[model samples]
Each structure stands twice: as C-alpha cells, then as structure tokens.
Target: MEKLLQGLIQFKETDFQEHRQLFEELGNSQSPHTLFIGCSDSRLVPNLITGTLPGELFVIRNIANIVPPYRNIEEYLATTSAIEYAVNILGIQHIVVCGHSNCGGCKSLYASEKEMQSIPHTRKWLELAGNVKEKITAMNIPESEMAKREWMTEQINIVEQLKHLLSYPFIKERVLNQTLTIEGWYYIIETGEVFRYNRHNSEFELVN
Candidate 1:
C-alpha cells in the first residue's frame, strides 16, 4: 500500500508532469483504438506488455479473461456494458482477449467443488469456461500430464472467449462488415513472450 502511494506521488511529480500535455489532451476525452480483455493476473499488465500509453487501449480484466456470451443488459452488466461502450461508443476497431500461461482461474476448472466451496462466486464465474473443460476433457489427456493440460486449456480459453464475443449481435455485425477485428493472445509469464492465434494455421505463433 505504501509502495503504491509512493508510486502515485512519483507519477504526480515526474511521469505525470513529463506527459502533462498528453494527459491534458486525454483529460477531456479518449479515443482508443483497441479493447483489451485480459486475465486479472498481476504479472500480465496490458499496458506494460503492449507498451501502450495512457488512454491508448481500453482494458477490461476478469477471471480467466472470459467473455461471456451476450445476454440482456441487466446480466453481467459491468463486463457487458464495457463491451457495448467500447465497440459502439468508443468505436474501437480491434478487440484482443489475452490469456496468460498458468492462470489460476483456468486451472481452478479442474478443482473439485469441495476445494472451491469457499469461493462460490469464483466457482460460478468459472462455469463460463465449461465449454473449454468439456472440449479438453474429451481429449482424454492423462492426469499425469496435468501441467501440459493446464497450459493447453489456458490457450483454448482465449479462443473460447473469442467465440463468446461473437455472440454479441453488434460485435458480430461489426466483424462481418470488417469494422471490427478480434484476436486471441497468449502470454507466457515466465518468459515474457506473447503469442497470437493464427486462424490460418490453426495454431498460436510467436508475436514477433
């Protein structure tokens, strides 16, 4: 807490002042080009990873970086509203759903109900990745290789959420008209490397 406070002070005294003009310009309004949906992992800082400046990317973070299938406004209001506003109001051209290696949320999918009883909301939220679990489980990977399975599931979750994003009618329309593009990203926390899904190759390739 103290560190964060000191960082805030430093930002105010140094970084903020260094970019005073840019901050002033962004004070009134922001026109970001992309909407980044990433996991709520401390190591996977979207701005730091993408090297984006303030107001460059509108970000939304959630457990496992899941994007639920579109529902009525009253449902999942926080995430849904951010999506609506980013695409419709902000006119964001690109949407990126980024998943990281060894994500606890994705790993928790394999946890028994007894282990998750303390986190009811989390257990419920993880239900959004049910499809990923089903698809992975069908592969019949051995329990001995749980580590490999976990990593695969993390990447698969990114693709799954990308599909969920299309469930939004507005998002679908924009995509069909080439007005908006959606991409899946995988980040390796250990190596600080990023990979992007290549639909053409049906595999994730290192992002240069």
Candidate 2:
C-alpha cells in the first residue's frame, strides 16, 4: 500500500506533468488505433511491451486473455462487451491477442479439479480456451518436456482467441474488407522478446 501511494505521487509529479498536454487532449475523447487483448498478469504490461502511449491502445485484459465466442445472450459479458465497444463503436483497425510465457492461466488449464475448485469462476471463464488443453494432448508432448508444453499452450491459446475474435460479425466483415487486421503475439517476459504469429507459416516468428 505504501509503495503504491508513493508510485501514485511520482506519477502525478513526474509522468503526469510530462504528458500533461497529451492527457488534456485525451480528456474529452480518445481515438485509440489498436485493441490489445492481453493477460492480466502483472509482468505483462501492454503499454510497456508495445511502447504505446495512453491513447494508442484500447486494452481488454483477463485471465489467459480469453475471448469468448460472440453470443447474443443477455448478460453482463465484460470481455465481449469491451471488444464490441472497441471494434463496433470505436472503429479500431487492429486487434492484437497477446499471450506470454509462463502464463498461470495456461497452466491452470491442466490443473486438477481439486486444485481449481477454489477458483470456480476462473475455471469457468477458462472454458473458452478449454480446447487448448485438447490440442496439447493431441500433440503428444511428453510430460517431461514441461517447457515445450508451456510454449505450445501459450502460443496456441493466442491463436484460439484470435479465432474467437473472428466469430464476431462486425470484426469478420471488416477483416474481409481489409479494414481490420488481427494478430497473435507471444511475449517472453524474461527475454523481453515478442514473437508474432505468421498464419501462412503457421508459426511464431521473432519480431525483429
């Protein structure tokens, strides 16, 4: 609590003053160009990773960075609603689904029922990417190869969420007309390297 308070004071005295003009301009309205869907992990700072300013990225963050397939149900729908507002209302051009290495949510997909019982809501939310585990299983990666399994799971989850984004009619139409583009990114927290998914190659190539 004390650390956060001091950080807030520093932000007000230094960072806020430095970006005062930009903040004033964004005070009335914001026109971000990209919708960044990323994990809620503390290590994964969207702005820090992308080197984007405050108004450049409209971010939607959640456990595992899951994007639920578009549904017409009447409910709160936090993630779905945010995606709709960014694309339909805000008219954002690009959507980036970023998943990072050593993702706890990705690992939770493999957690036993007993282990996940405490986080029932999280367990349910992760069902959106439930098939991720199935894909890993079919890959036949040995349990001994923990690192490879983790890498595959994280990257594959990013692709799966990108697919879920296409399930939205508005997003799909814009994509078809070349008005919008969606990409998957895998971030290595320790290395500070990001790998962008290449659909043609069906692999994640280092972003140089």
Candidate 3:
C-alpha cells in the first residue's frame, strides 16, 4: 500500500506532468484506434508492450482474455458491452487479442473439480475456453511436458477468442469488408517479446 501510494505520487509528479497537455486533450473525449483485449494478469501491461500512448488503445482485460460468443440478452455483459462501444461507437479500426505466457487462467482450464470449487465464478467464466483444453488433450502432449502444454494452450486460446470476436455481426461485416483488422498476440512476459499470429501461415511469428 505504501509503495503504491508513493508510485502514485511519483506518477503525478513526473509522468502526469509530462503528459499534461495530452491528458487535457483527452479530458473531454477519447478516440482510440485499437481495441486491445488482453489478460488481466498484473504482469501483462498492454501500453508497455505496445508502446502506445493513453488514447491509442482502448483495452479490455479479463481472465485468459476470453471473448464470449456474442449473445443478444439484456444483462450486465461487461466484456461484450465494452467491445460494442469500442467498435460500433468509438469506431476502432483494429482489434488485438493478446494472451501471455504462464497464464493462470489458461492453466485453470485443466484444473480438477476439487481445485476449482473455491473459485466457482472463475470456473464458470472459463467455460468459454473449455474447448482449448480439449484441443490440447487431443494432441497427446505428455503430462510431464507441462511447459509444452501450457504454451500450446495459451496460443490456442488467443486464436479461439479471435474467432469469438467475429461471431459479432458488426465485427464480421467490417472485417469482411476490410474496414477492420483483428490480430492475435502471444506475449512472453519473461523475455518481453511478442508474437503476432499470421492468418496466412496459421502460426505465431515473432514480431520483429
């Protein structure tokens, strides 16, 4: 708490002052160009990774960076509502779904019922990525090779969420018309490296 308080003071004194003009301009309204869907993990800072300014990326962070298939229902719908605003209202041109290495939410996909009992809501939320586990399991990756399993799970989850995004009619129409672009990213936390998914190759290539 003390450290966070000191960091807040430091930010206000240094970073905020440096970007005061930009902040003032953004005070009234924001027109971000990209919608960045990323993991809620504290280690994955979207701005830091993308080198984007405050108003460049409108972000949505959640467990595993899951994008539920669009549904027409009158409910809270936090993630769905945010996506709608960013695309339909804010007119974002690009959408990036980023998943990171050693994702706890991805790991939870393989958690036993006993282990998941404590986090009932999280377990339910993760059902969106349930098929990711099935895909990994079908690959026959040995249990001893947990690292390989984790890597595959994380990357595959990103691809799955990208598919979910297209399930929205507005998003699909824009994407088909070439008005909007969507990319999947795999971020390596320890190495500070990001890999962008190439739809042509259907693989994640290092973003050089």
> Where does candidate 2 have its weakest 10-residue lDDT segment?
137-146
Q: Name the runs in model 2 displaced over 4 angstroms.
A: none
lDDT value for candidate 3? 0.96
Q: For residues 2-69, could you state the per-residue lDDT of candidate 3 as single tens digits?
A: 99999999999999999999999999999999999999999999999889999999999999999999
Give TM-scores for every candidate, taking all chains together and pairing residue i with residue i: 0.97, 0.98, 0.98
Model 2, residue 58: distance off in Å is 0.4
Q: Could you tell me the lDDT of residue 16 within candidate 1?
A: 94
Per-residue error (Å), model 1, residue 186: 0.2
After superposition, the stretches of candidate 1 with alpha carbons farther than 4 Å from their true spots are none
List clashing residue pairs in candidate 1. Answer: none
Model 2 lDDT on a 0 to 1 scale:
0.95
Ranking by TM-score: 2, 3, 1
Which pairs clash in the backbone of model 2?
A: none
After superposition of all CA atoms, the RMSD between model 3 and the true structure is: 0.8
Question: lDDT per residue, candidate 1, 1-208, as tens digits?
Answer: 9999999999999999999999999999999999999999888899999999999999999999999889875544778889999998999999999999989999999999899999999999999999999989999999799988988999999999999999999999999999999999999999989999998887999988
Q: Worst 10-residue stretch by lDDT in candidate 3?
A: 137-146
Q: Residues 25-143, candidate 2: write the lDDT tens digits.
A: 99999999999999999999999988999999999999999999999998899999999999988889999999999999999999999999999999999888889999998999987
